[model samples]
Structure formats: C-alpha cells, structure tokens
Target: MSLSRLVQRLRHAALCAAVGLMAAVPAAHAQSDADAGAFPAKPLRFIVPYPPGGPLDLMARALGEKVRASLGQPVIIENRAGAGGNIGADVAAKAAPDGYTLVMGAVATHAINPWLYASLPYDPIKDFAPITLVAAVPNVLVMNKEFAQANGIASVADLIAYGKRHPGRLNYGSGGNGSAGHLAGELLKARAGLDALHVPYQGAAPAQLALLSGQSDFMFDNLAAAAPLIRDGKVQALAVTTLARSSLLADVPTIDESGVPGFDLGTWFGVFATGGTPEPVVQKLNQAYVQALRQPDIVDRLRVMGSQAQPLSAQDFARMVAAEKEKYREIVKLSGASIN
Candidate 1:
C-alpha cells in the first residue's frame, strides 16, 4: 500500500480506540452509582474497642440490634479491646471506605489516647468519619466511708479543706496512668490546688476494689459501676464529675456547683467509619443509629446505667471530637500520662 494511505488507516484505528475508551468511562460511573445505591449488602461489622460487659461493648450490642432491623443487614459486634482502645480503632480506620465496618470509639480511643500515646497507629481525627455522638456517662467522686468519716469530709469543700491542711496525704486510685479516671484526678488536683498521690491499678474494677479495701483514699469512678456501692453505703458520694447532676443520683451535687466552676468531664463514645467513606453512606448510618438512640427503650436503659443518649449530627459530632481532642491535650500534659 502507499505510505500516505497506511498512515491514514493507522489514524482511523487510533481514533476508534479513543472513542471506545471514552464510552466506557460513563459505564464505569454508572456501575459505581448503582453499587452505592445498594449499600450494605452484607453483614456490618461494628467494633467495640473494649472487652465484653463494659459500657461500650453493651452499647455497641444494643445499637447493633437496633440498626440491624433498619439497615436490612446484621450488625455484628466485635470486641477488639487493647491499648486503651487503639487496636480496634486502628482496625476500623484501616478498613475499606465502603462503610461496612464501623467502630464504637470512646473518649479514651479518640480524644484522650491521641494525646496520651507518644505514637499511634491511627489518626483520631483524620482516619475516621464521625457518625454521631452516642452517649456519655458521668464519673462520680467517691470516698471510702470510714475514711470520709475520719477526715470529716462531707462535701467537696470539706474534702478540699482537708487536702489543703494535709498536702500529699490524700492518695487516689485509678484504672491506669492515662485512663479517664486518672485525668479526672489530675484535673481536680490542678484546679483545686491540692497535692495528692495517684495509684494506678490494672483496671477500673481493681481500682474500685482498692477504694473499698481502704487501700486508696479516693477515686473518680463511673457512676453506673459506683451506684451499687454508694447505695449499700460502701462509699460516700462527694460529687459528680459532670456539670449536671445525674438522675440516678439526684441528691449528689456537681463538681461545678460544689466548688470548682466550669468543671465538666465524662466518658463519651460515638460511631465512626473509615475516613473516606462516602457521605451518603455515612449519613445513612448516622440516621439509623440516631433513630436507635431515640427509642424509648434505649433511652431508658441508658438512663438507668447513669448515661444519656446524645445523638448529634455528623458535622456536630466531628466538632465535638476536635474540641475534646484539644481539651484532653492539656489534661494529659497536666497528668504527665504517656505511653511509648
């Protein structure tokens, strides 16, 4: 064939190939849109970064049961407890962004741990998409009954007076160095201008035991866990750590009201997915969980456990997380809590 004719034929073939590729792009986008429309075709894995029987684990199960019916798929709860909830959070953070995998992230996992740990596997703010803030349980300031009686400590003022009179005489116990309870104690010491020793235990249960055995002077404990003891007169409830008094212990005063103004801290958890999950999927998940939280049964159950179901929009929850992260940075430094 002539050279000019051959060149023309090659150009025509190349143009046809380009046209075919252009046509395929729209088809690919349509497939993607279809897949998104049919989200959650399989079981959803909800990771609770704590062991069984804990508040986070129980809440995860409750939410899973509720969301399953709405989403038309099983919401399986997985307990991936370790490293102050970092393990499970990392798992969800690294999961595919299709929104099938979720995590029940807590103050420890997302807010406190980011500041407490020297190095972390996941970026608390950047690694996950916030769905909604689920609930918050207050921590109560309790004293051993005998100790309180001996020290003449009836109110937060009395306790502060006693601590001032005998600096370094008051020692408190907590779950560990960087746990919420520990930070609470440190924050109290700083705000109240009191000197005290901190005793770290293996877990909250052990720390509560120490308090009961009179091995430690006082500690900040979860209201639900401390309720039975308070009811049985095992410990004296001084004040609640949150700004508002708990309905379960309506008689108890808040730390802010007691003496320290603007004092507010609690154990809160929320739902999160991989950072890049589609906005529509995140909204679907948020709506389902928020609906679950609003149920009368769920609200009543959480209230009995000294918690309140707080369902915020995804954007609002993200703002809360960022504020909490910054707040805890100061607290962690004040406590000098760190892990390598």
Candidate 2:
C-alpha cells in the first residue's frame, strides 16, 4: 500500500473506534436508567428510627401501605430505635444505594440532631438522597388541666406573665434535648423572655405523661399526640408553635400571635435512600408519595392526626435540609443546647 493511504486508513480506524466507544457509553447509561425505572422489583425495607406507635412509626406504617400498593411490593417497616434516631439513620445512610432500603427520616435525624450532637456517625446532608418531605406536624403548647386551673393560667399570655413573675418556678417537658418539643420551648423562652426550666424525658409519651401527672408545668407536644388529650380535657391548650394557627385547632392561637412574635417551630418527616441512588429512582419515589398525598382518604387521615402532607422534589428537599441545618445551628447557639 502507498504510505499516505496506509496512514489515512489507520486514522479512519481510530476515528471509528472512538465513535463506537462513545456510542456504547449511552447504551450502558440507558440500560442503567431502565434498571432504575424498574425499581422495587422486590420487597422494600422502610426503616423507622423509633419504637412502634410513635408519630414517626405510625406515619411510616400509613405511608408504607400506600407505597406498597403503588409499587406492587411489600414495604416492610423495620424499627431500629436509639440515639435520638441516629442509629437507624446511620444504618440507612450506609445502606446500599439500590432503592430497596429507605428510612423515614424525621427532623431530629435529618436536621436538628446533626448539629446537636458533637459527632455523628453519618453526614445528615451528604449521606442520604432525599426522596420527599411527606408531612409536617406542628407542636402545641399544653399544660395539665389541674396545673392550669390551680395557677389560674387560662391563656398563653397568662402563662408567660406568670412565668416571668415566678422566674424558673415553671418548668416545661420535652422528649429530649434536641427534639422539636425542646427546641420549641427554648424558642419560646428566647422570644417570650420567660425563665422556665427545661425538663427532658426519654420520649414524647413519657413527657406527655409527666405533664398529665403534673410532674412538669407545661409541654410543647406534637399536635397528633396532644390534641386528643386536650380535647379530653386532660390538658389545656395554651398555644401552637407555628406562624399561623393550625386547622385542626383553629380556636387556638399561635405562639407568634399569642405573645412570642416570630416564634415558629415544627417537625417534618420524609423518606430517604442511601447517597448515590439513581435520579430516576428518586423521582419515582417522589411521584409515588405526591400521588399518595393527593388521595382524599389519606388527606383526611393525616388531617385528623394534626399533620399535612408536603411533597418536594429531590433538589428542593436537599435545599430544605440545608436551610434547616443552618436555622437550627442559630437556634442551638441561642439556646446553648448541646448533646455533648
């Protein structure tokens, strides 16, 4: 062959090889996308970082049922309770990014606890891929009926004024140091300028029991847990910890309006998979949750529990988590709350 022709043929062969390699890349990527789209081909494990019957656990079960129906797979609930929900969250964070394992992440695990603890086993923001924010539940300020009646505290203003006059004589209970209830109480103290003592319990149930038994003067409780008690007259609803009044307790005023202006704290629950999960799988989960939230029966059920569905895209949810982390960092600084 002529030298020029030989060189041209070699160059053409190299060009063809490069084109073939580039073509194969997309084919592989497309196959991967197809596999991700066919996700949950088997059973899915939904991890709840708390014991059964709690708000997180109950919400997980409810959502799991709907997810199972939508995906045509069994959504199993696995309770791995401990370390203020860090244990199970760590498990989920380190899990395989196959979309089969999911965690029902709460504000404690996703936002608050990360800053509260001196060292966490997993990175709250980077360790997991956010699916969607399923729901938000506000905290209600409640006092034991007997305690309120005895102290003549009929309203939130009355309670605040009384706390100021008594200074430290009043105490409020919460699930634990970094819990939403505890943070709500601290926010109230800072905004309302009241000097009430903080009493921490192992969980919300014990905290509510302490309030009911008059062991604590007041408590900031999840509306789901405290609403029924307030309706039963076992506790007095002072106010809710949100910017606006809750529809479930329309008669009750918000802490911002009641006395503490600009005071708002609430808890949210969402689903998350391990980091590096495919975008298509995350989109699928978000779509399923958004659809579930739109169901009339699901809406009514969540409303009765003093919660409302809130669905967000993966990017939006990630931004929400970052904002929450910064917000709580300021809160922790102001409140001087540290787990270590």
Query: Lowest summed lDDT over 10 consecutive residues: which window, candidate 2?
Result: 1-10
CA lDDT of each candidate?
A: 0.88, 0.82
- Model 1, span 269-331: residue lDDT tens: 899999999987887888899999999988988998897788877776787788788888888
Q: Tell me how far the alpha carbon of residue 303 in candidate 2 is from the true structure, in angstroms, after superposition.
A: 1.0
**Structural similarity to truth (TM-score) of each candidate:** 0.89, 0.86
lDDT of 2 at 320: 71
Give per-residue CA lDDT, model 2, range 144-171, as digits (tens). Answer: 8898998899888999889988976999
User: In lDDT terms, which candidate is top?
Assistant: 1
Which clashing pairs does model 1 show? none
Clashes of each: 0, 0
TM-score for candidate 1, please give it.
Answer: 0.89
Clashing residue pairs found in predicted model 2: none
